[model samples]
Target: MVTMTSPAETAPTPRLLALRDAVREIERHAADRGWDGEVTASVFALVRTTDALSATPDLAGELPETALAEAASDPEHLTSIEQDGLPEATTLEELLAQLAWPEQVDGAAVVVERLMVPPEAEQGLPQDPEEAMAALMAHPDRTDVRLAAGVLRTGESWCAVRSRSHDTDDEVAGSPEAVPGLVEALRATFR
Candidate 1:
């Protein structure tokens, strides 16, 4: 009788090798820049999430439901992105410039929002999250805030769909009252 091999024992396919190489490049870049532990952890989380989503496209639909709901209930997760010392703006800008894939965009945005926006919102505005979020929404450069908002909104939308199907309340409530001003700012990107 022929012996059967388990899938886990099989060598990584070519695609997996490429992905591993890509991740290694990212790690080397992060190491070169002396990224903080939190930043590294967040990057790994994003990589895993992306890999999972790619392997099972159907899971994409289900991910948002649970993730968004969790984020809504625990905004701290969004705020803690900076727990790993924020990389220098130039370093972050460089990294962003290097990211070419759509999946990378999604992952990068998640990390950026968690690291940059919350601290900005905290230091620049009121202590209360609602008030701070409002101020961020209204700020002249609300793109950062909006990006974060979009992530939050997207996550909440996903969470609602997957975990708590019965909950009708919008998971991402409390939009800043100055959203129109923010929208105007977004339109005038040249300014």
Candidate 2:
């Protein structure tokens, strides 16, 4: 006998579920920092749970017991390590272009926040970068949004997005390609 399963029935593999959890955790940490912030762009390395624990034994004790238990039983689990002191870059694209990860890094993720206006409000914008940003920030309908995207070396990917207006755990939305460009860029780092 043969069997077939629908896409919804097998959409999330163990590894992909683990990837989603890791991405959400990163997004939550960003939220906890409060919205009184700059337009920041940050990158993190997603190492295997076991590898991360072994690499920082002292840090393991600080992790929640539930997390430690999950890490021990699930080979697909991942731990996020923030990458700091990145070289200065004028744009997020430029920053991502400079990244190249070691073979041991199982995946990568990034969180970027921006202030934006509706498409109709973008017309007749100032040509200068500083002036344009100021205009956007001052627009009556402007919104603040944060995007978190992650990709594994094996090709699985996930994305989560939260808007300042609806900034709650239940309000956050996610999809495999919520931020396609960012996901592609992170995947390139593993190439």
Candidate 3:
């Protein structure tokens, strides 16, 4: 007789669960700040709780003894550390291309807002980057989107996207491969 496996048996690993939680936490934090339509992105570094505690001893005061003990012992536990704001003029791709993480940085995440239009709207976009952006922003059918993506050095990834039209916690969607390009870019920083 063969024993059958169910969907529950194929659940994501603990590391993935932690990554998802961290991504959502950051997403909600961004949402709390309210949308400002800023071009600069907010970036963060995800480190092991143990590492974060060691690197920044001040964090110890923020957690209770039991919580600190658990975080110190749980290798899968992670904490998010927001990095400096990106320069307004620099594109994410350009900034990502120049990034090299320190040894202690286990992963990285970014929250960015962009104006998106249907594929057809991009057909006649100008060749110049500035012109293209202006065209996209001026498009009548554009949608504002806030995307949060994170990647771990161990090859796990998570993404959350919230559109301004449905800007609610319950409406935010998340998945491992929801935004492949952003995931890939974040992963490159680990290398």
Candidate 4:
């Protein structure tokens, strides 16, 4: 008579092994890049999983339980694995067959873009006036809209400074003294 093995006794599947390898590759890349800051942090926030087998709670685990537990509890490991970049394969079939999942890859791209690119107003602003405005407006907790408004206000003040300096022949348009007042004004608005 033939006997059937229980699910618990079954060997790990090839797909699962591939997935584990992909995760490991991502973690290695993240470590190499020193990606422990805002970008990786955001990626961790987005793709974090509660699965017992997928989490990386420990730095090194000799047993399955310890490894699984380590993965689950360690946000840094999970974030690094989820956010690391992947190379683009030639074909969709090749890509699909090679990686964990397309959704995970796409999510990582979104996190990278959001972290790397400054918002619209901050992009292509003039070096002296615009950069000064951006510096004046930046805040740790402010929303993008609020920050943009601050940028606009600072830009207007810079324009005024430029006009006044031109009229007076004082060259105060790009002077260091102008930045403090604008920065103070921006800080006051937040209050």
Which one wins on TM-score?
Answer: 2
Error of 4 at 17 (Å): 0.7
Off by over 4 Å in 3: 1-9, 37-39, 54-57, 63-75, 85-89, 126-134
- Estimated TM-score per prediction? 0.21, 0.89, 0.82, 0.21
**Residue pairs with clashing backbones, model 2:** none
Shift of residue 124 alpha carbon in model 3, Å: 2.9
lDDT of 2 by residue, 79-118 (tens): 8889988978998888998999998899999998877688
Instruction: For each candidate in the order shown, give its overall lDDT on alpha carbons.
Output: 0.31, 0.85, 0.83, 0.30
Give the per-residue lDDT digits (tens) of candidate 1, residues 1-191.
Answer: 11122466665443333232333333333334432334422222223344345566685576557543543453232211112433444453343333333332222222222123334545657888798768776765433211111121122111001012211222322221212332232222212
- Native-structure RMSD, model 1: 18.5
- Tens digit per residue, CA lDDT, model 3, 1-191: 11122466677787887788789888998999889745368889998888778878999998668657767667777788888755444578878867778888888888888788999999988999999999998999999989999999989999999999999988888888788998998888877
Model 1, global lDDT = 0.31
Cα displacement (angstroms), candidate 4, residue 81, comes to 12
Q: For model 4, what is the alpha-carbon lDDT of residue 126? A: 62
Candidate 2 C-alpha error for residue 146, in Å:
1.0
Model 3 per-residue lDDT at 23: 90
Q: Which scores higher on lDDT, 3 or 4?
A: 3
